[model samples]
Target: MTLAIERPVGVFGRKDLPDDWAHEQVTYFQDPETGLRAIVAIHDTTLGPALGGTRFYPYEDESVALTDVLRLSQGMTYKSAVAGLPLGGGKAVILGDPATMKTQALLEAYGRFVQTLGGRYITAGDVGTNSDDLDVIGRVTEHVVGRNVAAGGSGDSAPMTALGVFQAMRAGARAVWGVPSLAGRTVGVEGVGKVGYQLIDLLIADGASVVAGDVNSSALERVVHDFRGVRTTGSIIDLDVDIYAPCAMGAILTGGAVVDIRAKLICGAANNQLAHPAVERQLADRGITWVPDYVANGGGIIQVAGERESAAMDQVRARVEKIFDTTVEVLDTAKREGMLAGAAADTVAEARISSSRARRTSPCTR
Candidate 1:
């Protein structure tokens, strides 16, 4: 049986998130002692406890923040399912400018909220947050993980995410061509944040011409200073490049841009790249091969989960390296079944999750 959540009627005067965002739990938290306003959305726990990073951003209002957390937590559920992790998906978002409002008291208060859920959701770092921040959260709750290596946790997920995108981009290229290589290919990357910057390092080293863009001038300047000869684009999405990597935020494929997209492939570290759930068909219709964002960005979660299990770098990287093969499999399944790759990937994930759920609930015990 499926559960249907009531839409936020007249809340934003428009539907902000997708219709499919019927989550298992959507929780709002506020601490007057620390001035913390947050939302935590748990999408599923059929596979295991939900594990996802907690993002901190200065959203315009509570409606916008709720919309973001709902979509992001749902994406994490799909991401975890498709990545073959033994965990489910959930996410927390702290609604504030991290630079101005982040304090130990606030994080500890937020940690208290996490503990109230009793480990059904785990929080890490995303956007304005960092590993040190998770360490602070950990001090208040055992549900939190993904701290710095010195703090007995995975150090950073940015590099792992970059590596995964780079590998999966090659796989996308190979599905179009006959080989997995990006040499001499032009790749446009939007958003030069931690993961985007690391991805640039791999692309340049792989001999691909890089075009970069960001709203922040400092980010663009850092890219120009670190890597010369790379083209800086006014609009990264409109670049006439071989591949388009949207590493910033989600919903890049909305607003009629999908029809005129010139890129041969779309593979990036961003989650929920599709604004609409059905947008994968649009990419397929446009003849653009898209490695589902979750599959491509699974490396970060893989790293964090492995580290939580006390796995070494070799083990973690070995698992992350499988993303290439998984990319190929998803594309091939889509092609053979005449469906969108994202949908095909969802089929695979749902099958695995269903089997797990059935086994967990069956009373045919020995």
Candidate 2:
């Protein structure tokens, strides 16, 4: 399922960004005619062209959008590196409410901006965007992925992402309880959105008790209706569960939240789960097995990346299931070095990036 994607020769070279920025490129585009305001941040391209999703949200201001894109793009860099993919990291954010401002023309305008990058950035869907939106963008540029399967691109990535999280949860269970099963454990899931919904489905099938909480009542109701005997809770983090799954937005594991979490293991689909890196040390001190967010949530990216290369669905599924191995390796590394899991993951990913950098700059190649 893992196919080689060759990086374009000389397409990117290491350079310090403006203001000593660590990112490779940051672009801000505005289309007055279509009422589009967007930011695209390409953090690294040592492995290949930067690939990530476009998130459409109504930010309070451009500054907030900039912060989100930078953090997310950087996270993508680490995610791809640790997943052993030959892709780099980048992300885009459209500054508008999807419900009110999402139009075909607006998306096309965004696509045109993406086209300007000329393949240095490849985009898909995130947050408010979906496969349908990617189809619209595809009409403008060839650099889009994760479109509808009927449209010759991979469909929704949520299910594959959930599968990866389930595998990670199994790995974490093994590390903590000496078994790789969630058969009799209780899991508290925060966020029953696309990824969370499918994750709950898997956990239920594995015979694990599930209690979920979501801000959207309809999403929670849909889970209740579709699955029998599933419980709904007011606060997922406060529950006395064996595992806590934050499948929603990022920074759910803040300092205060980590102190109150009753779960023995923390593994979920959310990115940037820790509000700060120091929180990982807190979780470690508390004896909670916190699987790094990027390590646990690499499934969606792997699925979409395979779709970009025309890999079959079966192959993609097999690749995603390997999250179990990656998680176990990371946990083992952390324990052996007496470091937090997140720090250990960062060490592993950074080593890969550094090695790639060395290869790219070697005079023997030139």
Candidate 3:
């Protein structure tokens, strides 16, 4: 149950990075009354602000929690830059079960930790954190997103997120199969959470048949009832479908899931889809096209970062449509270079970051 695993060398070792890119910092928060402990890791600020969601989970070890925060925050950096946002990356992790240890005090304490960083990092809701939990953090600082509508914030990112994933899925399908629409195609959605359910809805509306699964019986039932064309299954990943949308937790695509996957294209809103780089390679070897999670699932961040909500949503839709173009581009690049989709994604992201930096620092801009 150790959270620590083999990772890129400098990912956790921030000291090795150049000073300009090495603003990586970590804060520890503890509420003696509630016995709640959490860690917030801010990765970089090359763009503008550091933005990432806060996740609450029962992490087995401190290192595992730290690693998750680091990797996710860095991924946020790439995601924002690639999506043409002015934010960097940061993330927070509470090493406890959300269903059991979550409390207002814990969230407030975590928000205080965020306050300590001034305005360098902003927090939003992740897998284990919700809008209600974010409301607690909002009491401590304005550096929070995903606030409830009653609180003058966009509470649920599910619909926007699902739209982005659907756009990416469409792009992937068209690029790979030359089909411009999802109609009549079978899509397997793993996890019928807020995002997953909406994704299923969009797919079904577009004439795509969906088979869904979730650990929550109520959620599964709701999806099945609302979408008459939809079917339910015990295990989501094992479903035989043309496309597999993973809206659940990270690392689900690791190990046997990669090899056993029957889907032609893998795309979803799940962060860190591949358990490791090797799994990315395995997907490539299996000829499964993958839309990088950070790139495909960046609509939520883009929506929250911009000032104009409607404009942001429109841009999110447009950007997500480009995921198809990017996916096709990456696939072509990989086939020519004999590389994995993940590596190609990294190359593209890195180049975009570099180009953005150069454009910003150019003499003409000055």
Candidate 4:
């Protein structure tokens, strides 16, 4: 759905998503004192309240942030539903460079704005934000998750995200190679940050040879130091590996990148991996097995979702492990229907949400 927001003088430009979009709710806020200009989009709440993370990042314009948050929130809606979480999708994006603009006061200001939503949108750590930042947000509002363990919340969902992706990679291997193992497989990881590093750890532990790269030299250096003998040829994106894990930003699979991909499987933690619908067709035409990003990288939301029900970590982790089965099923459905795996996964989540909506009517009306 298309949404237009009137911007105040000197604020970021009018809010707009990259593509034509429709959403349940889109709210805009600006706090000049804290440099907090934000957009929160609630894609759906048919199953439950809109739950997702707050991503802090630098954007060239407000429209860019709007587009990112809208897509991300919608993905969270599908991610939660596919993962069997009793929650809907929503996301908030703060427009600023987190590296330079982050402060306790700013986080608290953002939390206060979130409090205005009255828990319809749950905020967590994403991109440039973390649990430490969530703790600050939590201090101001009760509608925050992924807080520090000292505060009685699950901390650092990157490991769980990685675990789920690792399981998803196994499912991809099964779909493409007729085996559920990454051992002896050469995988190229394009981004060795929080989730990427943890995924690298899992690959190493599982006896897979990993070739990792990152924009951050320090992060790449750490991966090289931690996992010795790992290859880093020219660009990580150009590696001719069996599996390509894009544990970074999205849109790598679109345009010429789709033609350049030499991997048999594409799976990673990046959101919005497919730049457009036709890109999915491109990957399918090339005989690549792609695990939907939302389906494969849903462990973080599963962890934070457990907090709402006061579930234990073991139970949460077990729930996260179910991604393996979901990934395999989505791939199977895609193959049978001749559709993209992402579309198949979205159908599963949409069906669940639709069923819930259908059940909402009163018996008296019927």
Tell how far residue 90 is off in model 1, in angstroms. 0.3
Q: Candidate 2's error at 110, in angstroms?
A: 1.0
Q: Give Cα-based local distance difference scores for all models.
A: 0.84, 0.88, 0.77, 0.85
Q: lDDT (0-100) at residue 202 of candidate 1?
A: 96
TM match of model 3 to true structure = 0.87
Q: State candidate 2's TM-score.
A: 0.93
lDDT of 2: 0.88
**Between prediction 2 and prediction 4, which has the larger TM-score?**
2
Per-residue lDDT of model 4, residues 85-115, tens digit only: 8898999999999989999989999999999
The C-alpha RMSD of each candidate to the native structure, in angstroms, is 3.1, 5.9, 3.8, 3.7
By the TM-score metric, which is better: model 3 or model 4?
A: 4
Give Cα distance to truth, residue 312, candidate 1, Å.
0.5
User: For each predicted model, how many residue pairs clash, with residues at least 3 apart or on different chains?
Assistant: 0, 0, 0, 3
What is the C-alpha lDDT profile of model 2 across 107-194, one tens digit per residue?
Answer: 9999999999999999988899999999999998999999998888999999999999999999999999999999999999999988
Best by lDDT: 2
- TM-score of each model, in listed order: 0.93, 0.93, 0.87, 0.93
Superposed model 4: Cα runs more than 4 Å off: 1-21, 362-366
